[model samples]
Target: MEGQAKGLLKLINEKGIHRNTKFLAIASGKGGVGKTNFAVNLAYILANDFDKKVLLIDADMGMANVHILVNVNTKKTLKDILNGERIEDIIFTTRNFDVLPGFSGIDAINEIDDSAVYKLVQNLNDISENYDFVLIDTSAGIDNKVISFIRASSKTYVLTTPEPTAIMDAYALIKSMKKLYDYSNFKIVVNMVKNEDEGIETFERLRSSIKKFLDIDVQLAGVIPLTKNLQKTVKKKQIISEVYPSDKFVLHLKKIAASEVGEPAPEIKEGFWDRVVSFLRKEG
Candidate 1:
């Protein structure tokens, strides 16, 4: 499988048919805010609805569950790649898109050294150019691992709810990250909102805080409504966009996807590989 994937990638490059892939990281400051579900559904919408190839990386290293949410069982994960397995062999392809499952319950993988982490990022960057988008579902919090992924991506989306605690934490994340890199490209997405008015209010509050304190402008991506059917879809271990195509929740997601479908990815000041290596070295 690894060889075949490589061969296909080579053919595409030879034909001059590949485009620059966009790397987007979806993260939050606290868990249970439905960040992973949003990442999975967004990937599905980009692939199935817009006919764009997408790769979803479960970057929640220790407690990854994107595979479970999508109801796909995998024998290997990012740990295997670190243990010398070909990245192509470990990638699980579904009808919608490809997934690079993350490590779960493996202490060594969870505590991977800077060198190993850099290698993993490099491998992902190598194959990323083959796809239209690479979306990473990062672990919640402002840890080194989480910040590293955000800094390396073309755009980092901070997810939060209307709750005050979640909102504060989200702001703290942006503030912390701003200290290390530019915050001009940060995007905000308010989730589990009761209505458009609620979502807009939440976004405004966060944006005002950032501008006043951090002095940076964050773009509003889109708002996801709180729908009862979303819980049912998750319980059934299915993607909302696919199972409930016409659901209001899915419709809003499609709107977000349409907004970004053909836009060129922002050019990183330093290349992806260089940025990853520089971040690791600084942390080391």
Candidate 2:
């Protein structure tokens, strides 16, 4: 099945692998934020609609389930790559994209070391050279594994919902990441929204919280509304965008993807210190 999927991707494009690749890391502060769902559908849309060569790296490592979500069986995973295995042995194809499956089973994830992380990043960088985009589906929660994937990527997205806990955790994750690297390339996506106004409200609240406490600015890439078909698609192991192309939810997601891949991120303005000083001076 995996090989057949690869053949499909190859048939979609006769030119073989692409040389320019963009890495987009999908991350969240906690589990159950639908990060994987977003990653899966986004990759599918890029592959099907945009006809781009995409590689979905299930960087969630220990708890990787991108394959399960899509109901595809992978023969090899990153476990072999970390154990002195050649990278070529682990790459597989999906229905619409290529996937570098994460490690599975028996302490494979727990045994990962700095050397493994380095090699993983290096291998990913090399693979990116041959694809149009590499969508990294990072593990939920603020673990070292998640951080490694997010920090290594060229772009990172923080996903949140209208739920209070989810929003707070998302903010926390953003704050923690900012401590390690510049958050300029970070963007937000509010998922499972009830309506457009609810989505905007959620974004505004989260943005305000970050601006107030962390004094960091974030861009809202877009929002995904909660639709019944989302669950149906997941149950069927299909992408909402593909199964229901005409669905409003899918259309909005396509728009988000278009903006995401169509342009480079705008330059982030001013350092946190500058923002703090400005606020203090204004108050005085």
Candidate 3:
């Protein structure tokens, strides 16, 4: 353990090492929207498709399951570090991913103390130099801790489903952050869609509401089609990208990763989400 910690520390402290590290925070307007799945797959694709070093951080304080989703049993998490355990000690490695899993049984770290939250993110940002990208998977809700994580990140992805409640929640999350931190660097990912058209329409409706009322722009990053493979992989505790690289979900994810790392330029459309959705669906 001590040796591993030392190695991890060295990886972080070495200057000009892994110079491409970009911190991205993935959040959902509501739960069960597949934000964690997107985070895990995007990190893997960035590493495999783009061949960039990637590190996944489970920033969801009270409820973390990235390890469970990826089928790794962990003995430590980010909470252990915040509680005085060494940050390097909590680091864990999987077959294709390295992760800093969040605390266990921590349903409400927001109630813990503001200083602890500050210190946690500070330590995280400090040792982030080792990887090319640091993907933070946060919990649902726009609480203080989640907002802080979103604020500290260089970029953010706000995830949602096609449900009305989910869209409202997504809007609430974005609006709340704008009010709190004037956060504007955000993108939207419509998950679990039946097709690209559904994804685009869902993205458009939410995009229009936020723009009309909040006066903020949320980019539609892309949409993930609802796939049984994604659901099955999670049930079996494996990554779909590892099990089924040819799946359409993986393909879209690769496209998303390419855009993130500059391999492919993302298509940008301007208009209310409803119009974008209608146009894409009709074309489909």
For model 2, what is the alpha-carbon lDDT of residue 138?
82
Q: Write the per-residue lDDT of candidate 1 for residues 118-181, one digit (tens) a residue.
A: 7776787677767888898988887745566788888888899999999999998888888767
- Residues 1-284, candidate 2: write the lDDT tens digits: 99999988887565543344566889988778788888888888888888888888887857888888888888778777777777777887776688888764523434556566567556655666567777888876765545655665667888999999989899888888787555546799999998999999999999998888888888899998888998898888877776789887788779888887788533323322233223323323
> lDDT of each prediction vs. the true structure?
0.84, 0.75, 0.76
What is the lDDT for 132 in model 2?
A: 78
Q: Give model 2's TM-score versus the native structure.
A: 0.79
**Per-residue lDDT for 1-284 in model 3, tens only?**
99999988887666644365566889977988888899989988887777776778887766788888877788887777668777787887665568887775444453446576556556665567567777889999875355556765667898889899999999998898888668777889888899888999998899899989989877888888889998888888889999999998999888788788873322223211222123323323
Residue 9 Cα positional deviation in candidate 3, in Å, after optimal superposition: 21
Measured on C-alpha atoms, candidate 1 has an lDDT of 0.84
Task: Give the top-scoring candidate (lDDT).
Answer: 1
TM-score of each: 0.88, 0.79, 0.80
Stretches of candidate 1 above 4 Å error?
1-18, 104-122
- State model 3's lDDT: 0.76
Q: Using lDDT as the measure, what is the rank order of every candidate, best first?
A: 1, 3, 2
Which residue pairs overlap in candidate 1's backbone? none
Q: Compute the lDDT of residue 124 as modeled in candidate 3.
A: 63
Give the clashing pairs for model 3.
Answer: 21-132, 62-106, 204-273
